[model samples]
Target: MDGEPRTNPDVPRVDDVETWTHSGLQAFLQALFFVLIVRPFVLLFLGLRIRDRGRIPAGRRPFILIANHSSHLDTACLLNLFPIRRLRHLRPVAAADYFERNPFVSKLTRTLFHILPIDRTARRKDASGQTGADPRQRMLAALQAGQSLILFPEGTRGNANEVTRFRSGIAWLAQAMPEVPIVPIYLANLGRALPKGHFVPIPLFVEVRVGEPLLPRGDREEIRAALESAVKKLKDTP
Candidate 1:
């Protein structure tokens, strides 16, 4: 609770239990089964390599993980590299338009992993003419409910090593939930292994670097600048 409350606040409170129980036991079991039994083999077959994973924080506090987007592989790389203890509590903020389009994919995303639908184009009117929920509000609600979120502040994939301008939405979230730590992560060689528009990933050594958690200290711009700096440092490291 850092910033002023919104006029139409949809964010859940810090101690809200409804959000915590949204996904029931079936979801948890499915996620456990996939992560422990299925995902390891798939990652091994893909020749994925994760390094510098010790940087991931060990405690359980709501966190915002901001990373530079390079390819779809970024998600898998980060997921695999995260500490197993934290994996159960992590939720990736995926685009509503993309992942929710298909029923099977949507169910799998929600059940196998805690995937939240973030409307990137929240201001745009849907086919039915109703506006979508504010992305920042949705993200805040997730954080308030004691869940960690992974977001690509760039909004989409871009060239490897190229950090796009950090979006202001991340700044808003940081300010809104100052208690939650903002973690900076970097993925190396993912763009080369599976660049934009390529369906198949080339077998290559992938590297992941997790930087220190960032705390908000100043205004929105200052916090965003700090977050951007941390992410850039991870991207710059060899």
Candidate 2:
């Protein structure tokens, strides 16, 4: 995975005609939910200590938000960074297997978070020997559609305050769309607030350190390593 990539013909390239914008009503409802419900809960309970927020790419310019995952709350916290109006186009990449398993929770997460669910199962060839749909294509489509994305490159949640090795999917995305900047964010104490199994969250403060955007500056391996390093550097920030 060290080299630059080739375009997948199976994946449709985003043209000016293809877009994924929300309707006026949809945007209104999203703002209502975030402001009336989510905002109060976060401020009153999960207090945030944010740093370098000014560095987040502004005004609908498509960008990738890469963060160290520790809990489900990670997505929620990251989503909070944007303004109410931007919530309509914001998408967080989530696991289809888990979030979509239950119909009720699936509806909740989809309508509220606007998650782009990816099938994390092993990609295999069918009886005809055609491979499965590449998850990266879906992410690439979203980016091309001009929607900002939230990605947990660790692939899954880990121990709180711990940065794990990132998979190369992000590298592939960076190479696929080098124009889109990748912003690194480090979140702390979310795992303890809402751990892997529990439901109710503990009132713990979360520290979010946002780093400067990184371009596709190197080969796939170097890009992945550079992403992991940026988040780790944020973790060690004062």
Candidate 3:
């Protein structure tokens, strides 16, 4: 979700998102942030719940977890959905322009979440007419290093009431990293709490529904369709 959603229009737009910070201290700080900030934030507002957690394999095995994107809360909600065993290795894929646009946000997103940045401004092809390297390469490398990812393939926040068609980049990533499985997630009512404009969240009771993992199918369109269907199936889950 091409980069992070414009949670508020007042934030600045910056250049590329950097990944040069990963230290033990950063990891510790991330843990604290999750507990001190993220945990309380979600608990106080969202009636967040995860379903079908058993479908996801246990241990440190890396898998791409894709979810519907509506508000900035989607990121936080997804992060809290996993158990402690998997949360340590899960990284959110955010848009560079939104999060990296300011010094404060860049530090928070990079140091705490260790997010993978996608160049939202990139053209479809480079000057030579060949496709440029995907932003998900960083995500793929993270997976190779035993880290999992939370991705929103709609590439942008959609209306909370409906899901948009997913971009095919997810399929390519799945094909390239076939060793990792793909998990589909459905988020409901997140957008109503904080859609595109409002900075202060409205304290809505959001729901998180996790689906079973799907092995990467090489066909991009087919994979996208299946993922969409899977997410739709969980959209109305209790």
Candidate 4:
């Protein structure tokens, strides 16, 4: 009962853990890249001051991690918070067009970040104009398989210190997976360190505040508002 996935029967499950599980060599490579490269870059180079870390789900349980998107570094910073062992189950939802643009970038992102690519336009169209599988179903399948997700409800990166209007995609996911927890994270100064369209990261101290998991109550608008308010509250935290 402990290891079994708890989800509605309507949600499809990838029967094989192999879908999410990596080979021994692949696992070792991922850990090595994160530990030797990413961890040091996020922690030592950029500097991190984390709060409410205990609020992050202890183990590999299914949850949606919502954060304000201001910089590309936001994902790296959040990914660095978890231990190496949990990295495999932690998938960051990224734009398919950007992350999967080229074969090289796609492979690198898949190896380093294990990103869950989503179509920003929601068209689900490929380069050949063929309709691809629904990104929402991909998310549902991942959740059904006991994986946590990192989602930037703001959708795209914006001005530093400004949290834009949250997209309703999160609300849709929340409605579908009522049993799953939705965690809010407020990132401070990351946008300044690595703002949009910037390459080299500035050496600025970053603050990561984790808030209580949100209760997906009311309609989609109300649920979206609640999640937005939670992240904003974290921004105001001293």
Please list the C-alpha lDDT of all candidates, in the order they appear. Answer: 0.72, 0.80, 0.76, 0.81
Residue 55 CA error for candidate 1 (Å)?
A: 2.6
- Stretches of candidate 3 above 4 Å error? 1-21, 83-86, 123-133
Model 1, CA-based lDDT: 0.72
- In model 4, which regions exceed 4 Å deviation? 1-21, 124-130
Better of 2 and 4 by TM-score: 4
Query: What TM-score, to 2 decimals, does candidate 4 have?
Result: 0.87
- Rank the candidate models, highest TM-score first: 4, 2, 3, 1
lDDT of 1 at 202: 79
Clashing pairs in 3: 2-155, 3-95, 4-95
Candidate 4 per-residue lDDT, tens place, 82-193, comes to 8899888888988877887777787677777888776675443444355444567777778987888999999889888778889888998899999899999999999899
lDDT of 3 by residue, 1-238 (tens): 3344335433222322233435668878888888888888898867676677677766778888899999988888888866543555777888877887887898888777877766665445344354433565656667777778889999999988988899877887888887788889898889999988889988778877778888957488888788888888888665
Over 8-110, each residue of candidate 1 has an lDDT whose tens digit, in order, gives 3332333443463335574666557567754664377566655556666667877877888998877766666565555667778888678776777776666
Clashes of each: 0, 0, 3, 0
Pick the winner on lDDT between candidates 3 and 4: 4
How many angstroms is residue 190 displaced in model 2 relative to the true structure, after the best TM-score fit? 1.0
Best of the candidates, TM-score: 4
Poorest stretch of ten by lDDT in candidate 1: 1-10
Q: Clashing residue pairs in candidate 2, if any?
A: none
Residues 44-153 of candidate 2 have per-residue lDDT tens digits of 88888798899998887899999999887888888888888788678898887788777777666777787777766524322335454467877888887778899999
